[model samples]
Target: MKTFTVEEVAQHNKADDIWIIVDGKVFDVTKFLSEHPGGKKVLVKMAGKDATKKFKQFHNDAIMQRVGLPMQIGVIGAEKKEEAPKPVAAAAAAAAAPLTPGKLVSADEARFGDGFPYGDPNWYQDWNSPYYNESHMRLRKVIREFAEKELMPYCHEWSEAKAIPREVVKKVAQAGFLNAASGAGTNPSVASLLPYPLPAGIKHEEFDIFHEFICVDELARCGSGGLLWALQGGLSIALPPVMNFAPEPIKKKVVPECLAGEKFIALAITEPSAGSDVAGLKTSAEDKGDHFLLNGEKKWITQGAYADYYVVAARTGGAGMGGVSLLLVERAWEGVEARYMDVMGMWGSGTSYITFDDVKVPKTHLIGKLNEGFKYIMHNFNHERLGIVMQANRLARVCIEEAFTYSMKRKTFGVRLIDHPVIRNKLGHMIRQCEATHAWLENIMYQIKTLPEASQPARLGGPVALLKAQSTQTFEFCAREAAQIFGGLAYTRGGQGEKVERLYREVRAYAIPGGSEEIMLDLGIRQATKNFEKRSKI
Candidate 1:
């Protein structure tokens, strides 16, 4: 690559001769100099024999090692990005018009036009996304603002302490974020598509709810996977069953309580021996006409430490899924207690082992119906998985963003490390994966929002299952890569540097939650077969 001066690179109109390829993420600095926020100083500092070392010095490791993947932020001038290489163009030659009007060029085009350096137009001081509509845009803005102000400020400290102030959760609840599908006059099941009845003109309200999800995504930027997981798990457990299965009287009592921060709920399914094997769960609820006597020990339950109510899945019949039923068990019931289960991540999520010693649950609190609890559980796993999926995607995004920023300012070997092709390729792949996963997730999310709730079936399970597997796996991969990129600092408790180190310790749990990778695959295979059979009209 021909080296150019800061001014030359900055003034690099399309006509500039020298191509300044900074740290390998690629940039067509050809015209960026004029548009840069820092003026020529930023580029000038990056000039000279090798600015890598100085660049490293200027930025933090988080940015250098974990800049976000491609296309998370809207492109400023995507038209000029250097395209990835094309396959051998054995195609008959075709001419193409260049921007210069009369200039003729070969039809072959690079996949990415030209990648710009960090701190370019497409960059955010942090993360940003351009979703489908105004509601999404507003939501993204709200989340970004919140992260910068609230979480970003205290994230490093909290990561070190492994404690998210209860105030944070309380504030989030106050923000009306927890009321996702079940707004006033909106039946809980109405959140589902297909047969679920819903009031007209509520799509916007639903869209607003998804925005709250954005708040959750941005929370990961705080750098504590465990904290994010602990907080979010409540949403996963509480929303679907309570909204769909709880009786109106129960809903009236609990929903408002949950919203008021006076109570919390969780869906209890995992047990000491039956972590992902739902069918093997030994939890049982025997009917005594007026109430059910339950006996089981549930482990690794998020919110277990504080949940005032639980959507408990129990063995109501004989064996397998058919024998199962969901019951809403209140904490006030006799013989119910939760013990803390210390963990590597999500420290304050109040994870615990919940024991039911002949716990008495009223018959009215049964979730869904007897022998039909499995379907209701199945009904919401996809949404739960997607939530996991988004977290995984966002976690990777954090890695990329932090790494990229670090790489830009950190100088090593006399230049910004990003100028190295090897580093760029490594970081580039991370970016690509995150963006691809995000795109895939957004597509599925759109479908879930618009598809009729009635049409959701066991067959639909396959897609969500596949996504759950893919999302967690993707997150784990990116986290590892980001760690490697950060080198040493990634290993230590960077204390307050948005602890990527902390994330490494927490990555394992992400794979475990919302059903382990193994369970996801098994469920995916079964659902895929069902989908295939339906497709064949079998």
Candidate 2:
């Protein structure tokens, strides 16, 4: 058992302090009298001495079980706070493209030291970050406002209760963000880029249009993971086929309601029978004169419960890939049923299992050509994967920030845990992963911004798919690491939710969503091969 000297204790504001070394671990017992799980008398006996002997005597494994886990034995001590560098407030820095116009620049600027170079690994400082556009700046202000004023106060409480008020949703809708990529009633002078949802065409505007990505970034930062996913998912559902193939009447009816936030839509491509193998789905929609009878059950549908319409996938042809088709299914129509699903995370996100039992959808709502839903769904998968990538990045960011905070406060061995080399390694590794994810995401964002909207996904499919798979995996890993770093605090969740706790469940969904990593990799490698072969042929 290790003991602290009186001179050493008094030097660090220790007056009538008692220190105990338990299981070869030293802890300041100053604040642990009542808080200690082993009862005050037991701890008070060896208040000023090392409690290892008594702890062993008291433990004997039987008492260990009674006192919970090893982590609950909280450590207390003095900590040397690292002064946080002042954030630059220059409006230019705030608005300037941090990376290619739609990317995130890590907040870890190493101006204070060598390792802190912006965003962890110091890998992306050389990469051209264009996230500094005017709209990017404006959106940042709006999102910050939303997070601090509108979302923050209630976030912890709401997150714990697993509920978010609908009024907040209405406010987000009114903010015109659900449709930021498309210009719909949005002030053109302020949000000129809104008209183009996916950054398709318009070379200069498209190249510089960073606002669209910022909308998702800031919204995710709003503390309510469920809300961000719901809103972002809705926007993503609005972007794909409607922008490229839907007729005017159909587009007008379906698109505006989403921007207005009155209606909801979800892309349903995965079937329980054929999860990632879209070509293997048994769900089919048969032509019935003026309509199609969509008979299928789409599992893990995000926003399934309340979606006004579904960007649904079904088999319409013979077999394999050629037979797939994407159709719009409105909940108002008969035979459409949605059942709320209890998922691991995103509790208020309204995910569900949807069944269209001979549901009739007008031919007008048919997306693209009858046998072309495969292309639409495939093309749309890129953006969906990118969206999931964004989620992964944000989850990593939350974990890093929370862990950094915890490290500074959590004490061990008479000093702050962050000051320990081993603890710093936890942060260092997570940071490296963070930088990698941000860099890859930004690179993809740049490509997505420049390509003509007509074929952006096809052009960047390989990289986007690979990054989506990697980023989600990264999210899951970081969440787990964070949980371990926080130890006991992460498991007991009665207050502000542990990010790892939320993300642990959330990240798993990402692995399965969009497409599984194994599928993403196989598909991405194939696309990449084709991309090179075509380039060589050209």
Candidate 3:
């Protein structure tokens, strides 16, 4: 491009031929005057002058990169000054120091875990950890790579589409991620459903709850609750009951199909009139000998629009918890209706409102014993709560990472934002919550691992519920702080603060689902006290 002198550029000062300089670059924005989001008057006032200050005040780097660069005519000659001379001693010191922008550090060299303090679990970056091993690290690398390369780049676009593409679901399944996600990898019968082997180094037999936690954590790094849920949210919750309690034939038929990514399923428990109060659910299923006549409506059903099957909860007997029963209602059955719901967030998860009008569910599809569904539901809550904890904590870390990176780059008052004490204080609070919640999560995971399966619901439910509340609260705080840090950028969508904006919208989704914060707090205390009484002689 040809350079222009200030004197030479001063001639075109009229509206017909106007030129403005921004960041040492000349732009011919005359044609864009009418097209600018701000009216033409604004552009006309700044015509034929350096508008860097005015432009930056109203626009972000994304706007300039997308629009301003295309209008550039030439660089301003006065802005092209040569590098200043450095002292001889300073030059020697600079040459010996590491390169600017830093060299790429491989995982093998340091296992530094993204090099951000509290960006990941403390153990991830060589901190002493009893839970994670080489296999866990390998799995973490695999998942992180897949998320960054495949999912993160397109998450915003997918969220806008309001549905995760079927191909993406299949790819995730084919990579054996769904198997691990749904707790199928450890079950030999269902493990065979996986279309591919576990990511190069990971072994199916070795896969445990911690591995599942890692998968959830790594996927949440993509920073879109919608995308994460769209892919596996339903599978993680709905399929477990089938594997654990469904009849062998039904399990065989449904598990393989769902795990193979050929079909989908969702746990239908929450209703329009009932949430947190499961016993208050009014969905009814009348006995009809060979099959039950299921008639009810389920709201906030994640992945419901695309599900091939629904593990629905309905009232089978008189009243209260004793009356509930679990039924695997197939979507193809008559009178089954599902439509997409426009929720506050998690748009791509296909959250739906479903109606089952006299739908026939075979007796064989009843999960566990009849009228004993409440027990099964209670058991599932522990796992569900843990899943919520994992995602919420990771999302909290994501806010930290976003705000931290942005603070280092964004400047104010002639210094980087991080140099400000108030900003640093906000970050300190966010990091402390994140790290404390993560530690609690890891400790809970260890307890879940050591405790026998039959005893888990009673022993760990309270703690997990408490952790779930803690993590979600932390997530809410971090999202708010990140928004404060990014200012206007965090308010707008699809730019540098894209994740922050999206995640901020998603805060309530996490807080309310799995279990609401208020309910969780109450239940945590109630369950803990009951368990303690049972264990104590006094």
Candidate 4:
């Protein structure tokens, strides 16, 4: 925190004691000279001088925070104080004011992060939104801080390691995020079922879909699909079936441990022979007097290798969807096996190929009634698809934020990249798509919250399917465009374009999972056509 004049900094110009200033902060890079990826010569050239401009041309903020900050020695001058954000109470009061024809209602909510135009939601930039209130803003600040402090810094490391540390998982659970992740915002009944209090002191009575949305949005802002999937991908989808349909005794034993982060669980539906064709899955379970014998394989099961339990779908009777049954299978049970699978992306997610060779499952472990598993699986799709939609859209925005940051700092043809009309056009398309996708997601969330519980699946499934397709497509487009803007940096695994490179690799994961684009589009249109026919007198 000590201040130094530029002349004083320049005195340490020798390679043995080099110091440089970046963005008005002094860093002693004498020892880091050898460690520099660009080699020691680059640091030698910039030693004892302001390298802020040169630093930005090759690296982004992620590098400065993750690498340069550790070497920071002091500031160049008096530190500028950041203005405190407007209070949530004031924002709410402003939002409540009556609107008039010519005047704009400036809620002026305290902006989150750097004011990077559309880098965040409009509401994050002080725009008034009917959907959010004080609690939403409070939760947003808390979750964003949590993500930045706890998860963001280590995302790349975790992804490359192909596993998240056990301690980090425990930290998330202790923070009560695991319970929130499992609670589908569409289901109010979930409030009663949570084993832990909500984070940010959000009262159970006031917690709703938007709060859940904030959690998903903030978590995705970390910009690593592998890390996000490693953290919650399996738990969110697999735990719900157990929470909602498993026998009370099974729920009593399993739900608490999983929600507490003491154990892990995965949903096993996709087989080597089937992905979307659920009925064709060959996993079979046969009834015994007090147990069911389960035998078959489930491929591409997220978190399966680490899961202590699996909510498995197996054929219990004849054929097709009618024969399928969901059963809770313990990983420790005899003849159960899981091995990690090498995949193109989601490296930290622990994707696995699992086998059950005559494993005996207690009859009491059956989830809901026999032959009703198809309905249960279908019932979970809207929530699952919605989770995918939220993650995909936010990831798209990350591409925009990263690319925009790079464009402003990076020069091409002796001008910043933003000065080019073509680059601006690409940004315009990316921004429009991201914002549109977000608006649609919020609208869908509104419907999910407002609709009657019994009518939700039938009423919203088609729309949710369409939104999933839309979000994944938008994510792909943005990732590709961001890569183009970053050029060679996007091709590299780290540095200024690390996120764009990673996101480009992850595009297919979002598009193919939940449901493929082909299937989602067909399902969406077919459902809409049926609804149209039902309403028409023709």
- lDDT by residue for model 4 (28-140), tens: 99989889999998998888899988998787666777788999989998877888955755543454342222335544434556778688988777565678876777777
**Model 2 alpha-carbon miss at residue 475, Å:** 1.0
- Candidate 4 has an lDDT of 0.85
Model 2: residue 116 alpha-carbon error in angstroms = 9.4
TM-score for every candidate vs. truth?
Answer: 0.72, 0.73, 0.81, 0.94
Better of 1 and 2 by TM-score: 2
Candidate with better lDDT, 2 vs 4: 4
Model 2 TM-score on a 0 to 1 scale: 0.73
| Error at 481, model 3, angstroms | 0.4
Put down candidate 1 lDDT per residue, 73-127, tens digits, no spaces.
Answer: 1222233457773332211111112322444444342111113332111212112
The global Cα lDDT (0 to 1) of model 1 is: 0.62
Residue-wise C-alpha lDDT for candidate 3, range 1-538, written one tens digit per residue: 7799776667667777878888888888878877887788887787778888787655545456556788999988844667885543343233322222343333343343567767777656544566765567667767887877667777777877888889898888877788777767655666655666765357778887788888889889989999878888888889888888999899889887887788999999999999989999999999999999999899999999889999999999979999999999999999999999888888789899999999988898899999999888887788788888888899999999988988887889999999999999999999999999998988988887788878888778788888999999999999999999999989987767888899999999999988899999998899888878888944
- Stretches of candidate 4 off by over 4 Å are 79-110, 184-195
CA deviation > 4 Å runs, candidate 1: 1-131, 181-213
